[model samples]
Target: MNEAIALMKRHRSIRRYKSEAIPLEHVRLAVEAGQAASTSSAIQSYCVIHVTDGLKRKKLAELTGPQEQVRRAGAFFVVCGDTRRHRLLCAREGRAYEARMEAFLLAVIDATLFAQNMALALESQGYGVCYIGGLRSQLFEVERVLTPPEGVYPLFGMCAGVADESPMERPRLGAEAVLFENKYPDDESMLGMIEAYDERYARYIERREGAGRGWSGSMTKKFAEARRVDVGEYYRSKGADFS
Candidate 1:
């Protein structure tokens, strides 16, 4: 494999980290790399907040599953989807900023792409990184803490620092299950692939976590109930339209 592909394959979601601080210059370079990521219609609808306040970080950690990484990591960032600039542009022309689901989707996709690029850049610098999706646990509290305008939505948090642990790479489904020739495979074929994956996943979990759980069992229980049902309402409050 090429150097880039090898680097990509070595990705691990690092949680524990050493206390060494990442230089501010490195952080800026990472952001620059993130800005280089592709955007839809050239609408750079994203903003990143570097949270350095000790008190704010403590509160955010509490809100987001008390994930201590937020408070203790060498650096922490909150990636947001922003449409405020577009709204102001419409106002400049005395036109209404009509909210559409498509626009909202574009902002979300753009922000996600930017974040992944930023994470990859940080990882390339030898800093371990972890994405904190638990930030969605309390979107309202996050808004109160960040105090972003109506058009900016905090999507997730990220922590980057020197690695303190080396974790085994998690197993994923094989190409035969995920890739297809022309048409989607039948349910029977998909189930067979998933069953095979479950066996491997169970073995991995037993080795790493001493748990016998498999992907299907965990996913089935997780989706058995509607989760984060209020996320849509939170977006609506930010003037995002679902219709």
Candidate 2:
């Protein structure tokens, strides 16, 4: 395989890390890589806050369901979609600042692209990274941690450091399963693909014996016992428009 393909295939989320600090230069490179991602209308509506304070890290750990790896990582960064900058610019220019869903979507897309670029750059530099989606579990608390103003939303958190050990890469569904041509495929074919994927995933777990639960069984149990709540209220409080 080509080097890019090999690097993409070898990428895995690393949660555990050794007790070491990343060099300042590497951190700068990773941030620069993130900034290099394409943005909508040249409005780079994203910001990254690097958190290295121990107390802040501990608070983040608590907010993110006590994820120990977050506290142990060499650096933690919060990627946010910020419309506040544009709003301020409009104010200075005597223009109305209308925050629309499209604007919010653009900001989110820009921020996510930046985060992915940063992840790839870090991986290329022999570092490991894990995206902490659990940051959304208590999104309001995260906003307070970052002290973001209105119109700025915390999209996700990333923890980066040198990996203490290598972990197996999880398998992805076959292209036939996910890639739909000109039109969407029928459910029968999709269902068959899902079953095959579940079997493959089950076999992987069986071999590792790490989390003996099979994919289908675990997914069923998760949704069956999960409770639905209005977490969007938190986002609304932060001036996000979910309407």
Question: Which tens-of-lDDT digit does each residue in 35-57 have in candidate 2?
Answer: 99899988998988889889888
Model 1 TM-score, 2 decimals:
0.98
Error of 2 at 40 (Å): 2.1
lDDT of model 1 at position 175: 81
Summing lDDT over every window of 10 consecutive residues in candidate 1, give the lowest-scoring window: 227-236
Task: Evaluate all candidate structures by whole-model CA lDDT and list the values in order.
Answer: 0.92, 0.84
- Per-residue error for 88 in candidate 1, Å, reads 1.0
C-alpha-based local distance difference test score of model 2: 0.84
Candidate 2 residue pairs in clash (backbone atoms < 3 Å): none
